[model samples]
Structure formats: structure tokens, C-alpha cells
Target: MSDQLDIDYTRRNKKPRSLGDSERAKLEEFIEAIHYSARYSDNDFEYRHVQLPKQMLKVIPKEYFDGARGTLKLLWEEEWRALGITQSLGWEHYEVHEPEPHILLFKRPINYQPPTH
Candidate 1:
């Protein structure tokens, strides 16, 4: 029989699919998208890289074209700091841009900074 989500077998890991509980208690945040933009207007904007987990690179789909992009995931501060990626901006919230795909961007939360241990 299907689960509450329906047409499913067993749920792997956990529920909600946002951020799991143990992952939450351990303080982890991740976001993934095929496209992104900061605003509704303007043709384009600039962004700096906030690299994702190393495992993410493993699933890159085969390129059909020279510039074919793979998955773009946002690995927030807590997620990558222990792995020694210090440049994380720890951003959140994403919105799709029209006539665009294969990009990711976000609004840097006010005074956003990872906690120092």
C-alpha cells in the first residue's frame, strides 16, 4: 500500500524532506534548485560561489552540451564549516527567474554570520 504521501513504498531516512531531525539537532541546512534569481526584473546579476558538499558532485548528470549544468545545491554554513569550507554566506530563500534555468542565488539574511565556536 502507498504511504501518506501515496504511491510510495517505504520512506528512506526521514520525513518532511526539508531538514531531518538528527540533521537538525546536528544543525544542518541544505537547499537545491535548478534555477534562481534575486528579483523579478533585471536580466542578470552576479553571485559568488558557496560550494556544496563533495557528495553532490557525484550525481552530476551527463552533459548534453558544452555548458550543460548539473545540480546546484546550497550548503549553508553549518553544513560545510566542519568540512573546512569557511567562505559560506549561509544564505536562504530562492525564487525562480523567468526564461532562465540552471542557476542559483539568494538574499543574504541581515547580518548573517555563522556562529564561532
Candidate 2:
């Protein structure tokens, strides 16, 4: 879908808005894209890493990306947890002298699973 979410980032009272139908569908589409890439790997021993650029990052609600740490996790934890995926923002170097650019890392089978303790 090529629709933009009508999110008001400058609101008061700090009320959180659930993603619109199109937005949620887009999120699931992105997940499916990542899932398909990880589909053939061994579930127990292998993980897939998908690097998304700023363009693709638009799929996510801006609040999550712009908020404090743990905010993003809190927003999408359910879906991501079910898919064994975890995300973080980091830099990637593309050239010897070029400045590194911020990127999102989506990794499968999260590095550390839930601790039984």
C-alpha cells in the first residue's frame, strides 16, 4: 500500500494511537518479506538478518522509531516475539572514508531467548 498514516506526532496528553489498518497490514507485509528470507534456514541453529534502509523504515510508525529505548520493543513485542525476531538501530559503514549511516537490524531467533530463571 502506498498510503501514508495520518499520525499526529505533535499531540498533547501523550495518548498512543494504534496503527491504522493499512499500517498494520504493511507491517505484516514487511514481516512476511523477512520471514520468507529466513524460511529455509534451520529453525534451531540459524538466523536471518535483514538490513532495511530509511525508505523501508517508513513501514514502522514514526513514534516507535523516534521514541525512547524500549518504546519500540513495547509497541511491537507481540508480533516480533512470535516470529523470533528482534530489532535494534545501528550504523553500517559502506566505504573507507564515508560516514556510517544509521540502519535497523532485524535478526531472527533472537540472540538470547527468554531466560527460564
Candidate 3:
């Protein structure tokens, strides 16, 4: 794994001058979760969703989500399997780190199929 997290700042616009304290905290939480799941799961496990705390949402703008989504996906896929579990079970297993702040968990529908046209 690379020492730096891969965030797509160009997708939206110019790069963020810097991350705010709240944004940084949210990012850290996200990174840790990915690392933990990856460390514990096997190659069969797939990333089904991402749970973001509500409080973190308030602090992070939509741009952050757009920019981070791709990077997060890559991290989850690359690291989560090396650990041991068969599959990412999905958002149903997600739990908020804090109760006061509700987080948005990104879950990919199991039935999702690509368009063949």
C-alpha cells in the first residue's frame, strides 16, 4: 500500500488548499475503517458500502465525497482481502462510531448489473 492516500481532487475542480480539522478527522475515520476491514478479511471479501458519520457530513462538503469515492474504492479492494473474511457483508453490518452523529453508509446493491448496450 502507498504511504499517501489517493484522492481525486481534479474530478471536481482545483485541489483543496487544505483539509479542515473536521474533514481531516472524517478522512482518518474512513481510512482506519478501510484498513481494519482489509486487514481482517480474505480476498473473497468485497467492499459493499461505506458508512460516514452524520456529523462528519456536516463538516465535509459534497466535493469531498466526489473526490474521495474513487480512492476509497481502490483502498477497500486492494487491502480488505489480504486480511481474511470471505465477503464484505454490506452496509447492514455497519455501525456508527458515534450516536449523536448519523453517518451515511454507501452500499452497492447486490443485484446491480452493468448495461450491455
Which of candidates 1 and 3 reaches a greater TM-score?
1
Task: For candidate 2, list the clashing residue pairs, or say none.
Answer: none
Report RMSD (Å) for each prediction in the order shown.
Answer: 13.0, 12.8, 12.6
Per-residue lDDT of candidate 2, residues 9-103 (tens digit): 23211444456667776665455444222422344223333343334456666664434332233223343333323443211111111121123
lDDT of 3 by residue, 1-117 (tens): 111223322433342334556645544544434322322332432233334433445444454333434222222322223212134433222322333223322233343344467
Task: At residue 15, give the lDDT of candidate 2.
Answer: 47
- Ranked by TM-score, the better of candidates 1 and 2 is 2
lDDT of 2 at 11: 24
Q: In model 2, what is the error at residue 45, expressed in angstroms? A: 16
lDDT of 1 by residue, 6-115 (tens): 21112121221243455433323333422122333222322333334444333332221123233332323343333233434444313212223333234443444566
Clashes of each: 0, 0, 10
Displacement of residue 35 (Cα, Å) in model 3 is 12
Which 10-residue window of candidate 2 scores lowest in summed lDDT? Answer: 89-98
For candidate 2, give the lDDT.
Answer: 0.35
